[model samples]
Target: MNHYRKIGNILESAMKMVLLTGITGFLGGHLAVALLRAGYKVRGSLRTPSRRDATAQAIEAAGGNISNLEFVELDLTKDAGWNEACTGVDYLMHAASPFVTSMPKDKATLINPAVEGTQRALSTARNAGVTRVVLTSSIAAIVPGRGKAGPPHLDASDWSDPDGHVNAYVESKIRAEKRAWDILQPGTTTTELAVINPGFIVGPLLDSDPGTSGALFQRFFRGEVPMAPQLYLHSVDVRDLANMHVAALTAPAASGTRTIASFGAYSIMDMAECLKKAFPAYREKMPKFQAPDWLIRLYALVDADVRANVRELGYNPSLDEAPGRALLGRPPIPITDGYIATAQSLIERNLV
Candidate 1:
């Protein structure tokens, strides 16, 4: 009878468990569903417990298994719940970093949480004996410091200069990712670290909250943006980015490194063209004319959002995603598909 009970316990605990941070956010919500669909028990950490029911309903509506999903209240700025959150967790995916386009009145509002949150989370996860941590970084950490005069291509080998002339969002990502590596690089922690540096993420959202990237598309389709800027950015499907996070869990080759997950850089006009070709309804709404550099600079003087893009205006960024793609065992979802899905989801939700 004792032996049978032991066997029963073994069978019950066959599935692995993953502790995911920022599970209420757009990417985090998608990651939770994907992990559940792949048969892992997901214990998601959010700042507020009130969002659990809504998040669960959204995941369920998107065809995720809610039976194995659970939530705990945790915030990036505070250190109280991390130990409890990491307890008994097999994998840790830290996806909760503050992202914004406008430079805040105080930069530490973004920088402190991101760097300290990663440090706190990683330290706690290591203490709890979590095996691996996959941090959701961004291309912002890699793309800066590449002046227009420099090489056209960048890969995981590069790092963004935190001291460079970049907005608070880019600086926060740079500092946060560096802090993560500083913890893991010098054998400071037993836990392995893998980072996913995704570009402008655009794809179908499970909930009405289409993230910052989706907000850009929303403006485009709503005709809020009359003239597209000369900025170009590498776009990745949210689903593909989530997949890379899951794959990083056990991929031995993925340990102690960063992966750039993107289809390629598409200019505003280029993405608008893609939208126009895919959805006839957006043909007129999407900006066909690219704003000249001088006009963009003048607009930036008054618009905080466009001011953020001043550094990259007319600069096309090219990235090497082959390494990241190989790790996922699949190619990235096409750029056009990402845009179409993003638009369709927004339209369905009446956000556009």
Candidate 2:
């Protein structure tokens, strides 16, 4: 057998366990399904026992076998059940992190949980002798830009400036990812680390609670914003992002590497135009015009969410996906398909 297939057979024969965090969240839910389908015994962690049933149902609904999937109660902040959760697990997928568009009253509300939780996860994984950890980091961690024009392109080598005009969410992701790497330095531990830095994730939801990015479609289809804001984003389908997570687990060159999983840089206006084409019935609700920069700045004065996005207004950073694409062995799902899938899920769930 080839090297990759050899690892697969060993894992299958040994029933290698994988400890996955944030299985109740969007990306985590998909990761659970992917891992389960890959023949790995997945042990997922959640903050409460109440969410276990919902997560299991979501996995089952996604066509994942829950017989090989189990759940453990664990919190990022508290030291309750983390160590026990990592026990016997050979791989770790740290997909848990606070994601929000609104600025919290206190920045640490987001920062503490992310940083502390990453430390807790890595520290426990190291002590448990876990082989590798695939950390779900965001592109936000690599690039925090001001609204002003800057770099022409961003890649794995870049790092977000903490002092930049980024929101609490961006800051938290940067710190959490940095701490994770810090804990697993070359000589410090044998636990390997591979980080997947994906852009805005949007695709079909495996459950009712579509994440922050998925909810954008609901707003788009409801005419929540009559005009598209002057903001640019790089998006990746959740399915594609989940596949990158799985590929990172066994790729020979993935260790100690940060793979950027963004596909294309699209403006809000571009996204709305695509939505109009895909779902003509919602044409009236789709944004018909781009809100001028001055008007958006004016609204930011009174609106907290708009204020949080001000630094991103008219900001579209260049991204090169060659490295990330190489890891997937193909181009990511098209941005148009991402929008359609998210729209379909929202409609099916009666969310729109």
Candidate 3:
């Protein structure tokens, strides 16, 4: 076969292979579904082999090929086990990170794993000739929300200083993503990089394993939280976030851009009100109170999650979400869709 014909044939059979590092994560799980629907074979990794069964179930739920999905027990803190996972994968999505609310006494718990794990994943991909890599970074990496609201602007170029964050999770993500971006070697056809910076991701769980963000939204629906907070966020649905990640995998224009995706910014009362409107059943079930700033700070002292998240309540914040337009062909799922869907999901799962 001639060069062009041979290249086309190789591409056809390359399986459109992708390696998803956090297949069990909220976004990763959805991404596996998107990739499967688009005809790509996916391989995922966890810290242990035993986690494979859950990942398999997720792929199956998405109507994917359990046979097409493979899992590896890999550690982010060390280089071992990475090469095996990166082998023959066409792209890599580094979604694994230690999610937590409190600042660690030893920063290494969050920092070490996220930083080292990203290095190992990227090192392996570069060595393995992977074509593209998309990192599942949070807006937390871009906006740590430590103290000040911000200087009024930040984009792909902004960096969340490690010294400025109050929560370990934010610090870890900032440190990790910065470390990943700093990695470089002059070579073409090696692994090119992209980053997806999403705000609070919420949605229905495909299974019983509700993610951290999903579970928090559940509290709002259960009316367990009699009062909401001043907390506002420019959040996106987990499903929409997944689609953007897949788009980045092959979009040549996306190679170096950090696409900031958020459906719209809304607050605790605003979200509950949305649930009240879309899912009327939740109107009575959802919390109607909005916690005052003083009470939130008081609650933050004893509640670790509240304390770490206190920074999120400092002011009313919004996003310049229109920048992602060039990368998306259609508008993303609305932020409130996840809130309504969460209540429905809990009902469907009998978890309510």
Count of clashes, each model: 0, 0, 2
Model 3 CA RMSD to the hidden true structure, in angstroms: 4.4
In what order do the candidates fall by lDDT, top score first? Answer: 2, 1, 3
> What's the ranking of the predictions by TM-score, best on top?
2, 1, 3
Q: In candidate 3, which residue ranges exceed 4 Å CA deviation?
A: 1-14, 101-103, 146-149, 185-189, 279-285
lDDT of 2 by residue, 148-217 (tens): 5867777898898767887888889888989998998766788899999999888899989978987788
Question: Which prediction has more favorable TM-score, 1 or 3?
Answer: 1
Q: What overall lDDT, based on C-alpha atoms, would model 3 receive against the true structure?
A: 0.76
- Residue 28 of model 3, lDDT score: 78
Could you tell me the lDDT of residue 199 within candidate 3? 89
Q: What lDDT tens digits, residue by residue, belong to model 1 across residues 1-352?
A: 6456435434543588999999998899889977876668999997888888999999999878999999998988887888888878988999999887567889999899899999999888878888889999999998865555556778899888889877888999999999888887747778899899998888898889878888888888888778887878888888888878877887778898899988767888888888888888778888969989899899889888677668777666578878888876766788788888998998899998
Q: lDDT per model, in order? A: 0.84, 0.86, 0.76
Task: Give the top-scoring candidate (lDDT).
Answer: 2
Model 1 backbone overlap count? 0
Predictions: Cα RMSD each: 5.1, 2.2, 4.4
User: TM-scores across all candidates?
Assistant: 0.93, 0.95, 0.88
Q: Estimate the lDDT of model 2.
A: 0.86
